[model samples]
Target chain A: SAVISQKPSRDICQRGTSLTIQCQVDSQVTMMFWYRQQPGQSLTLIATANQGSEATYESGFVIDKFPISRPNLTFSTLTVSNMSPEDSSIYLCSVEGQGAEQYFGPGTRLTVT
Target chain B: GESVGLHLPTLSVQEGDNSIINCAYSNSASDYFIWYKQESGKGPQFIIDIRSNMDKRQGQRVTVLLNKTVKHLSLQIAATQPGDSAVYFCAEIVLTGGGNKLTFGTGTQLKVEL
Candidate 1:
């Protein structure tokens, strides 16, 4: 498993504002992903952060809303743009381990007011 | 499995008793499955995983059983403890342009009663 950490563990942002969440891993990894967990809901994958390239987003997600930047293999950032109350959710980052299993970060709890 | 309501399915178990959580997946071609536990204010933690070719897999005190015919899987925890109180989720891996993505179930909230 990999040691992953996220910055600004919890934040409250006003609607129409943007917040950037950073994820750092202890070691280099090829596959890093961002997920969203809504209140009282299970997780939903947002995008995959590809090192040195544009992130691959899932259906119903766009780069404009949730832009991702992976400058290196060990770090990535996800920015939620033009936040709304519906965007209030826990954002988590995870990395793929050796056996295809994933290790997750502590998660960033964001509340859009 | 899947639920349409806003609330999650919950299971209450006594401490030291056995607990079972069940899930039903959608994709029949999905070859990989994983179980995760999420505590309040924390990310999901990997518990155990199994493949389509296997029926059962075991971890420290947890066991995973898969039934391909019914597209169902289950997690069994022995001697449940207070620390085990959390939400459990089952996920299926599907091939995607971004690689394999996990599709999660509705999740079951496990409440361990002392």
Candidate 2:
């Protein structure tokens, strides 16, 4: 299993503001993904952070709202732009290993007021 | 556009008892499945996984059963403890045009009482 960590474990921000969450993996990985878990709801895939390329956003999510950057195989960041109360959720970063098992970071809890 | 889902939203069980959480997926092409545990204020932790080619896989104290005919997956934990209390999720790996991506289910909250 890969050791994954996220910066800014928890934060509170005002509406209309943006917060960028960082994900770092101890070892190099191939595919990195970002996910959103809303309160009382299931986790939704935000985007796939590809190294040196534009992130691929899932349906109902766009780059204008959630921009992602993956500088290398072991690091990535997700920026929640133009935040709203509905944007308040836990953001997680995951990496699939050699066996296709995924490892996740602690996640960043964002609360938009 | 395939999705994974769980049968129960919440489960309450006594400590030392066994617990079973069930999940169903929409796509038969998905060849990989995984179970994750997430505590409050924490990210989801990898528990165990089973491939579509297998019917059952066992870990230290956990077992994952997959049924492709019904598109159902179940995770069974033996001798549940308080530490086992958390929200469990089932995810499917669907190989799309981009690559193999995971789609997570709603999740089942398991509460173990002392």
Candidate 3:
């Protein structure tokens, strides 16, 4: 099993502000991803964090709103910029394990007020 | 767009009884199907996974059954416990240009009654 950790387990941000959540894994991993879960909703993939390259965003997500940086195999950061009340959600980070299975870190709960 | 979906939004089961959660996926090209458990305020935890070639796979007390004919999947947990109470999601992975994109279902909230 992979031991994944995230910084700033939660935060309350004012509108137009930004928050950056960090993710760290115990060992090197091949793939890292970011996800969002709106209140009372299921998780949605935001982007795929690539090592030494810009992250790949999903169709509904954009880099400007949610910028991602994965400098190495074990660490990454997701910044939610210019936040609004609609941006209030739990942000999660996950690493791909063997056979396409993913292990997730404890999510960062963000509330934009 | 490919999508994975669940039949029921929530399921209630008695402790020690078996619990079954069902899912339906649209993409036939998916490489893997997986089950995940998410507790409140926590990220999803991998429960079990089955490959496309296999019809069923078991882990610990959990059994995952995949029916490609109907594009359906089901997870069976024997002797369900209170600890099993959480939101369950079934996801399908399709290898894309970026990586393995896991499309998740709406999820089923499992409530174990003691």
**TM-scores for candidates 1 onward, in order:** 0.95, 0.93, 0.94
lDDT of 3 by residue, A1-113 (tens): 79999999989999999999999999998689999988777789999988988888989999899999899899999999999999998899998886688899999989899
Those runs of model 1 whose alpha carbons end farther than 4 Å from true positions after fitting are B1-6, B95-98
> CA RMSD for every model?
3.1, 4.1, 4.1
Query: On DockQ, who's better, 1 or 3?
Result: 1
- Every prediction: chain A TM-score: 0.98, 0.96, 0.98
lDDT for A76 in candidate 1 is 96
Interface RMSD of 2: 5.3
What is the C-alpha local distance difference test score of each model?
0.90, 0.87, 0.89
Chain B of model 1: TM-score? 0.92
* Superior by TM-score: candidate 2 or candidate 3: 3
Q: Look at candidate 2 and tell me the lDDT of residue B33.
A: 96
Clashing pairs in 3: none
Per-residue lDDT, model 3, residue A54, is 85
What tens digits encode model 1's per-residue C-alpha lDDT throughout A8-106? 998999999999999999999888999998888988999988887889998999999999999998999999999999998889999986655678999
Ranking of predictions according to TM-score: 1, 3, 2
> If you assessed candidate 3 against the hidden native complex, which CAPRI class would it receive?
acceptable
- Can you tell me the DockQ of model 3? 0.48
What fraction of the reference interface contacts is present in each model, in order? Answer: 0.64, 0.56, 0.66
